[model samples]
Target chain A: MRCEKSGRIEVSNLCKRFHKAGKDPLQVLQNCTLTIEPGKLNVLIGPSGCGKSTLANILAGYDSPDSGEITIDGSPLKGPGTDRLMVFQETALWPWMTVMENVIFGPTVRGEMSKKEAREEATRILELVGLQDFKDKYPAQLSGGMQRRAELARALINRPKVMIMDEPFRGLDDLTRELMQEYYLKIFEKTNCTTLFITTELEEAIFLADRILIMTFLPGRIKTIIDVDLPRPRNYHVLTSKKYLQIKAEALEYLIEEGRKCFGEDCNIANTMVDEFRRQADNRH
Target chain B: MNIYFVLPLFVILSFIFFIFYRQQKRLAHYSGISTLSQIKKTLTSQRFWLVILGFVLTIGFWYAAVYWLPFDAFHRLPGPDEVVIEWLSRDPYYGISIYTKEYYVHILYSTYRATVSFLLATILGVPFGLLMGWSRRFYEYSFPLVEMIRPIPPLAWVPLSILMLPGVEPAVIFVTFLVAFFVTTLNTLLGVQSIDQAYFRAALCLGASSKEILYDVVIPGSLPYIFTGLQISMGAAWFSLVAGEMIAAQYGLGYLIWQGYSLVKYPTIIIGMVTLGFIGYGSSAVIRYVGKRLMAWREQELGGLGVTYEE
Candidate 1:
């Protein structure tokens, strides 16, 4: 999908290695290259244990790739900066700091402005997040959904060029998750931020992303990129539509195939041979 | 157990009654006139007299312990009267001046020395903790040395303190400082380390300098831990002060208690012990009170509990 190139985030030839048992090296992401369009919600989805989270971490500067280049608006990403703010799945709002203080924390610490000025800026963001009343309340005082909102407010308060998220709503109950999805969509509509979100939830990825980058299993690489040409501010009703079901089925098929591959199971099978194969395998065992 | 035991038992029972009475009184005010009548009925019961009886019983036990105990190995020690008489009628060679009642003087001396040393330790310990807590290089290099030295008791340093310092004041101060210094430093370090990593990330992303992180994030984040260290260090100061005085001093409470031991004056020794106990308890309460007030923000996060450390 063609979108405004106001902020382009690109990762080229990304490579990362982690130490495994027996001092054996496990390559996490090998020569993975991708370009995320500016002001578009790009979702990364894959089967469990895939390297989507790792890639997101690399982009967020939480982890460094052994060799790669990640550039935002043509500037290379070296370490964590206000240029990119990350929202984690489990809300990482500071329990000690109040909602207002947590939101302003980044700006106040980084900005040359006075405390009063920083607070005013924070107040504006708090209102935007529908948490104006929770300014004085600690994270514990907030509901789980509210905490996530506060976390989003904290990240967005800085007006970062790219918003990177890792399973941002994985743990919430169904109702809360749906509510958060709606809330998140509304916020995205307002800001139009270039977002790179990682999730294992196929439906969530399809619903939120302009382009969903499906990944293969371990030592992950992009399996395919499915562009969701859905209209802006897509709602829950759109989930049951023909196009939505078509996309969901395709994503599910890809994931199930990947799962079979990981488990050493053949993806294709015949009904007659299934029983015979099981009997043969059982006899051999 | 008899009536002697009855007094303590009664005191405990009466304490329970007082708590219930207070609860009823609070409920009465909250629940309007109906509950007021109920509260009054509860209050009018003979439970109040039971409290009075309990107090009388305690006095009776005291008099019995004082007047009737035979001067034997385990007899209830001297009653208040005998102890009072002994206190009043004693001929004072030096008298009860600011310097004489070694109980009072020793308390003063011990308190002064411990306070001065603890303050000095705080001045050094807080900064050191902040440095070690905030700086990777400092934490990596200094933490190992601190860990090795921290477990070594302050009493172990008394000999070194005496040899190193030119005077007795220096020695006592050094020993007390050592006792409190580690607690303050380690507590501050933990406090700094325990601060949410997000706070640092938030600040760092904001373009905060390392110096700003120390002053703005690490110090404030670790204040609770620093206060905790100070409180613990106060206790350590008292402990080390006594040990220091016992080994190489002539004036503090420990020295007086030691002198009383040499002379076989058990009461004097007990008085000195009580004095030390009272000072230690009093200082702790003060530290806790101040810590709570200063760390009001912590209470919001941790309920009424002062500071709850997270693993």
Candidate 2:
């Protein structure tokens, strides 16, 4: 079900710093190199306050890195463009536009298609997101889940080469978030657009990623990369499978160790998760 | 009862028709209610009843107070009935009287000045303010001048305006326009500034050009503020119009008020005051109506309140 049109992304030693007028410079990202294969879902998971968001912003061309480069389809990115659309953590669907208007905004703005073609594309995407009924509703009029779906519809309509989702389901209730993760997997399978999905949730990463990148907090660094070899044509039922649990356990181990290092003993996930990682790391040593 | 009340009554009548028309439009989709019942429903609503009661009780109290109070007491603010009676009679000292064409002429000139000035302020200020908000350089360039000029009262411009402008009409309009224009420009600027940065970022990532962002993000995003500015501008126009006309106008509601005061005709002044009230209320109401129409998304956000007849 992978798409033929998906594009590869290369992040080479990306570094970014935030300088304050009267304060010491803060390093948000440093030496962060990652590769998201074409036609694959690469989930980047990290702890809160990690520089994942900064990296995502840099990749999306919303912000420039102090140093290093991001290339899509082997070409250096110029700036924010339709070719690389970023679905924001918060619902970024224009409240002023109805769902239909939000979906077609990219094509219309880019003059990428004829009027009839744009309409057809909008209809197809809205239907793909199961939002045809609510296409005329304002983002305010929609439920949280529907708004997320609408935002996804808005992003996918542009056929972005590298779809960078910044915790796209972070704010949803647990049930809806899980449902959205499944829904996104369905869309990802179809589009197969090289995705650099950022999240703080381990299971969400396990649920959607072909490869998972665990990042350190603050001066964000990719500490570990685990290939989720769990069988595809996947669903929530796979949560009970041994392979899924093993992968989840491995991700938790790395996340817990990184969480402990960055947050000291303060992180609850580290408190709960590091014992297992300690045992694993201790046994390895 | 008198001809002076005619225009005010006409305004109220049109206001009532507007309410009824809006109600009818909403009810058109409801199959359960007959058209007659829908009219009854609209008239009998709590808001409608409250409005009617408010007007009736206030007017009734004013009539009683004016009638019973001795002319010596409270310096004799004339009653509605006296204003109505004087409005009908032909005595220039006691009443404007239906026979006088002066009342209509004053009203016509005042309206013309206020309307022209108001239109000019709106056409000039809104875009300038929006640009100021949209672009940092524009804001930095113009904001200082706007701030420096904003505090100068419209009345303070009178002598300088009279000397600079060719005619009294233009001078008065200049003063009125200053007030409306300042309110409009500032509010439009606030509207643009109030827009969340996320909206601009979203627009940029979606491949919108700067022009498209202005149309889709900056403008529509700032509409609630724009309309609010317009409404405040409407009020400021009427406010400065009275002051402007009182200073230099040959004829206007402001002139009537001034002429009445100089001539010791309290009833004529009250009529002019009441006319000004009606005009201010009607203009703001029109602006609110237009705001409601342009901002359906806002209406949806605020749970459809203020945008509908019903809660």
Candidate 3:
């Protein structure tokens, strides 16, 4: 289900550097160029310290690139605005506010909708996220999964042009994380809004992305872009599919290579141990 | 026993019982037990019995020290029984008690001074602290001045306050306000600093204006610390209020205590001390209640975790 095309983001030669006292400037992102097509889910996959989050911050206008340009629908972005909303990895739902209040915060603050309209829209969005029962509950009262859902509702109600999710489900348990990935896919399929989702998980990238953009180790840059041609309306069943396995294997190769560069030989030894253990289990079976 | 002593004892016992009954009811609600069973459980609980035993032991020690001890200091001090009787007496031997207009007047004056000082401190301190935390330039310029002045004790300001202010009342208030103001401003500043940077970034990304960020993100984010500061400030206000009152005020609990000493009424001094304790406890309790109401989100967090209540 594709919606109207509006949120097309273009990044050209984006670069950023952080300077520490009495130390040389550390380059975070170097000549990062990418295009997030309107109405598509683009997953940017990378290892830890790969500057993917920094790139996400730059795109969301929370930080500016040292040198480069970012345009949304052919207009250069000036500063943080309602047009680009970010769903942070850490829980950012205002704990003081109830789920309903958090969901309606953007529209109410921006004066984009009337109070009645905002409430109605927020109610619909909460229902969509299956949080209608917990609308009156505070973030502290909710579980991690529910808080993430509430955060998503907070971002979605605004109808932002580009939704930047920076490792949104990074800290969830395995079961909850998978459930959220499936749940997120449903919303993405329905809204078909342009999304730049960042993650370190290869399986998550293959499971949810319309296109997977693999980033190198710091100083980060796009290493490869893999188009996911898997059938839509994705679920856990896709994990065992032949196409899914092929995409995962390919993405794993690049990820492991980058992970090795980032974490050095330690990552390689850990990877080898896992492979050895897998072989032993397979031989027993 | 006299009616005055008997009536007050009954009221105090009833209040304690009421608190226990309410607590049992709440426990029963959470644990799905009958209130009677919960009350029974509470009575039989070792924790409850231990607290009772501890109180009994302390009072027994006090009684022994006053009646049996040979020390001169022990002989001069009033026992718990003597203080309680004198506190409730209609025609008190020391000329201050439940029936005395002077006692009520002293209490009213002290309470009035503390309340005014606390209100003033809050009005000035919160915004000042917010600006200090919000703007880098403001913090750099004003924080040094605050640090320089904060270390000097509020009591140390009494003589200077008397010399500078128009009257004794204003002087007492000024001295009390100084301590509370410093506490509130520092806590509020720390509260703002404690806020996670992620929240600010989220607000900016959500397209909230600077004013909206302050109201929605910064204020709410720093509220837990602000409430904590307010509670501490309330305590500080009373602390300095009593000191200031003792030095300069003509009517206050502090003055009553001082006057009792000068007049050689040891029982009156104990009565004043007990009254001060109850009022100070009540004032802090009010601030805590208001803080709980304002930050219901924090209450839920603490409640969900089953953290025990502490003063």
Task: Give me the displacement of residue B35 in model 2, in angstroms.
Answer: 6.6
lDDT of 3 by residue, A1-285 (tens): 233678899999999999999999989999999999898999999988999989988988878889999999999988788778889888988888888988888888888888889999999988888888888888878888889989999998888888999999999999889889989999898888889999988888899999999999988899999999999888789887777766776677688778889666766675775466445444544
- Model 2: per-residue Cα lDDT over B65-111, one tens digit each: 66765545644788787776676656656657545888788878888
The prediction achieving the highest TM-score against the true structure is 3
List model 3 lDDT by residue over B232-271, tens digit each.
9988998888888888999998899988899899988988
Relative to the real complex, the DockQ score for model 3 comes to 0.47
* lDDT per residue (tens digit) for residues A1-285 in model 2: 234655788888889999999999999899888888888889999888888888888888888998988888888987888778888888877888888888888889889987678878899888888888777878888878888888988888887777889988978888888888888888887778888899888888898999999998778888889999877878988886667777776778778777776657766766566567446544544
lDDT of 3 at B81: 88
- Measured on C-alpha atoms, candidate 1 has an lDDT of 0.77
- Which one wins by TM-score: 2 or 3? 3
- The TM-score that candidate 1 achieves is 0.80
lDDT of each: 0.77, 0.83, 0.87
Instruction: Please identify model 1 stretches exceeding 4 Å from their true place.
Output: A1-5, A21-23, A266-285, B1-103, B196-198, B305-311
Per model, kept true contacts as a fraction are: 0.42, 0.62, 0.64
Ranking by TM-score: 3, 2, 1
For each candidate, report its DockQ versus the true two-chain complex.
Answer: 0.30, 0.47, 0.47
Ranking by lDDT: 3, 2, 1
List the TM values for chain B, per candidate.
0.71, 0.84, 0.94
